[model samples]
Each structure stands twice: as structure tokens, then as C-alpha cells.
Target: MTPIRPLPSYLVQRFHGWRATTYQENRAWYRRLAESGQHPRAMVISCCDSRVHVTSIFGADEGEFFIHRNIANLVPPYNPDGGYHGTSAAVEYAVTSLGVAHIVVLGHSSCGGVKGCHDMCRGLAPELDEKTSFVGRWMDILRPGFQKVAHLPDGEILRALEMQAVLTSLENLLTFPFVRTAVEADRLTLHGLWSDTGEGLLETYDPARGLFHPV
Candidate 1:
């Protein structure tokens, strides 16, 4: 195997500085966390977009949340076909092992994944339409969502699809037997959120109203 290159000097220096300060300020807290293991109350599934700061938005501390990130924060329907399912594996671990009380699906404005789905559905992005495209296959999970908003005008499609992504994930979560069992037993709850990155606004999905409202 090829030897991996060393990390950049600036990042290494920054890491050292952060380690020193953080350990100095919270050594006992860090030690306690290591000893106790994680018992987070919530699990957050969100986009891999660097602009979406899950920790910063929630002001979460170490071990406060179990977070999983993917291209568009999508969750596939439950399929126990013995296939390789990274997202499903994470959900299983979170629901069965972690025993988390809540699962939050967070979608954001101007998501490239959502835009790609829109473009592909509209025949604008042929590359994403290819069968070998991993992103295309992954985004296929949101095809149903795109269909629901396909009748809307071009200007309104992206935002609708973004919210749809959150709703889709929430719906898929229920397909998992463990998740459904926990929810039915009143042990777990589900939440959906959409963020307007440009405006720094957060909106939550209201299942009763079937809409997203600003928080």
C-alpha cells in the first residue's frame, strides 16, 4: 500500500492548540465521558455539507448527540436483504444499541444533492442518471419526493424537495422495525428540520399540519 502523506502543518498546529486548551479546561469532564461511555438522548442524521453545523446549531457538548452525515441526509426504506447498507446500519445501531430517545432528520436549503436530484429528474444532469453513479443511486431514495414536487414551478422545486428530503427520511425511519417498535412503545420520537442557511433560520416539520414552520 502507498504510504499516506502527513497532515498539513497548519491543521496539525491548530489541533495541538485545541487539544491543549480543551483538555486544560475540561479534563475531568472528558475523563468522565470516556469512563461512562455515551448515553446521548438524540441521534441526528444530517447532510454531509460542511456549511451545516449540527453541533454549533444545537450547542451540543461531547457525547451529547450521535450524529450521522450523508450526501443529502437521506434514509432508505427498511430492506433486510443482507445488502450493504451504511445508513441503515447506523440507524440500527442507534435504535437498537444506543436506545436513543429521539431521531432528528435535518435537511438544509441549497443542498447540492437535492439540486442534483431535481436536475436529473428534469433531464438536465445526465451524469447523475447513469446507473453506475453512486450519488445517483443514493439520490434515488428521494425520487418519490421529487415526484411529489415535480408539478411545482422550477423556482419552487428545490426548496420543496429539500423539505421533502427531511420528510422522506422521517417516513423511512418508521419502516425500520426497531424504530417503529420503539416509537409505538413510546420510547422514541422522530423529528424533521429544514434550515435556511442563507437566513440562518430553522424550521421544524409539523406532522399534524403537514408543513414546516419556522422555529
Candidate 2:
């Protein structure tokens, strides 16, 4: 068996620092959380972008949110083929087990995943078209979104497509039977949001208007 090496020195040092300060300062709180277990109010589906900090944005404490992040922050249409589906598994658990009251799909500007989808659709990036490319296959979830924005000017598609990711995820989420049942029973609600990372701006989707308005 391969031996597991010690953590990187920087991470070890950081852990030590956190253990001395933040962990110590909140030891009792941490212990209480451990004993109580988590009962987060919302399940946040967000992008894998390191810059998109979920907890910081909402001022949520530890265990307050069940966050699932992936490339482009996508949630594929519910498919029960007995195949591996990490995102779907997370959603199922959050809705059926955790009983989260809300599900939030959060997208962001300047997303590399969005750009990759755009480029791939336009034939600007062939590598992403290969079946062996995990990213290409995953980005297929957003191809419909591209079709929605394809008619717009080149400068507008990226941001528009970014918002489409949030919308697409929200739509796909309902394809799950558990999620659909919960929503119909008024036990769960879904939301879509997009953030401009550089501008620190936020916008929310309004189904009534079918547009994203800044907040």
C-alpha cells in the first residue's frame, strides 16, 4: 500500500495557526455543533471558482449551508441510470435526508467554465469536444443555454450565458422526483442568483419578469 505523506508545510502551519486562534476561540461552539449535528437551512449550488466564497457572501457560520460546487455550477437533468452522479447524490441527500427548506443556484461572472462552453460550442476550442474530456461532457449541460444566447452580440453572450447557468441548474433541479415533490408540497423552494465577482454585484432571477435584476 502507498503511504500517505504529511500535509504540505504551508497547510500544516495554517492549521496550527487556526487551531491556536480560531479553533480555540470557538472550541465550545465547535463542540456544540459536533454534538448537535448540522441542520442547514439552505443547500447552495455554486461554481467551483475559488473566488466565489459562499459563507463569506451570506455571513453564514459553519454548518449553516450545505454547499455543492462544480464546474459551471451545473446540476444535470435527473438521470437514474445507476451511474455515478455526485451532484445528484448531494441534492438527493440535502432534500430527502437533510430536508433543507431552500435550494439556491449561484452563478458568477468571468467563469472559466462558461467561457469553455462558449468556446467549445463555437468550435474555438476543440480539446473540449473530445469525449474523453470530462469538462466537455459536463459542459454539455450548458449547450441549451448557449442556444438561448447565441443570437446576442459576442460581447454580451458570456455574462448572459453565465446567468443561464443558474437558470439551467434551477430548471434541472426540478427534474428530480424528490425535489419536485418537496416543492409542490411547499416544503422546498428554489432560487437563482448571479454575482459579478469583480464588481461585488449580485442579481437575482425573477420568474415573473424572466430577467435578472440587480440587488
Candidate 3:
């Protein structure tokens, strides 16, 4: 079922007017994209949270970034038949087909997935039956993340867990053969990014320093 009675006039008018100007600026670009197909510079794996808009946050134009959004911006291990291969397939396409130079795992503060991990850690989450199966399985990807930050202060745990998840996904990305091959050949780079929604801050993970610092 869908509801359709609350359309805001201003927004509706703006959207309608936008396409004309947008098409003018991007007509050729769209034609080229349609003809040559996507050759994005980077692939951004980000949370589906409405507040975190990767393209808008980075000011990237159409076809500039290939993005995949999931409940918690996670990258599961390469499982060819784990029922749904949406996210993994997106990564494969970005690396192998699109030849994206960089793959960035972007995590953010106040993530629902992080919150779910916290709940699962406390043994307060729902049972792992068939009906509630995916929640348990999906959140398992962040088990090490929660474990890594378990000893930290309660207030800091969520953010730390989120950051650790980004690192975990970065490692998980290498589980795919194409990604590993690209990285080894110097055709790919992996990055972890954490955005503080409340404070409007962005940090990039530094593998050498083992910490995320201002970008």
C-alpha cells in the first residue's frame, strides 16, 4: 500500500523544475554514461541511514561514485550462495567491472546496526529462530567489532564499535578475489571513513597509525 496525499507543493515544484536544469548540465554526461557505462572513481559502502548521504557529503556528481547501502553498511564475507548476494555482488561489480580505484567503507555515529550489536551483546535481542534469523546472522559480522570495544566506556563503545566495523569490512572486502587482485596490482585502495552526524565531523582511518584522524 502507498500513501499519496501529503505532497508538499514547494518540494514538488522544485523537483519538477530541477530536471530541466539538471538535464542541461548533465545531458552529455548522461549520454556518455549510457554509452560507455559506469566507470566510477570509487565505491562507497555506507549505511542506509537517511542522515548520511555519501554523494552529498562528498559533493560527488552522478556516475562519480558507486554506492551500496545496507542496514549497517556491512560487508559480509564472500558467500556465493548465502541466499542473498546483493552487497557482495555490488562490491564485485565495482572492483571487477567498474574498476573503481578506491573502495571506502563509511560508517557513522548513532548507527542502528551498532545499536543492534549492543543489544545482541547483552543477550537482550530476539531469539535466533527462522523468523528472526537474518538479524542474528547479519549482526554477527560485527561480533569482533563489539568485542574489540567491549572494555571501553559505555558512551564510547558505540562509536568505537562503528569504527571497528569499518575496519572489519575493509578486511572483508579482500575476501573477494577481484578485490584482492586489484589491491595487489596497485589498482585499488581501501579506506575507512567515520562520520560524526551530531558534530558534523569526518575522520579517515590511518592504517599505519591505527587510528582515525581528521580528513
Models 1 onward score TM values of 0.97, 0.97, 0.89
C-alpha RMSD of candidate 2: 1.4
All models, RMSD in angstroms: 1.1, 1.4, 2.7
Tens digits of per-residue lDDT, candidate 1, 41-83, equal: 9999999999999999989999989999999999999999999
What local distance difference test score does each model get? 0.95, 0.96, 0.88
Off by over 4 Å in 3: 1-14, 127-133
lDDT of 3 by residue, 1-215 (tens): 67757779999899878877997777898888899888789999999899998987899988899999997889998778757788998998898888899999999999988788887886767673235578677878888888889999888888899998899899898998889999999999999999998898999999999999999
lDDT of 3 at 121: 80
Which pairs clash in model 3? none
Q: Locate the minimum summed-lDDT window of 10 residues in model 1.
A: 1-10
| lDDT assessment of candidate 1 | 0.95
| Candidate 2 lDDT over residue span 123-212, tens digit each | 999999999999999999999999999999989999999999999999999999999999999999999999998888889999999999
In Å, residue 140's CA in model 1 sits off its true spot by: 0.4
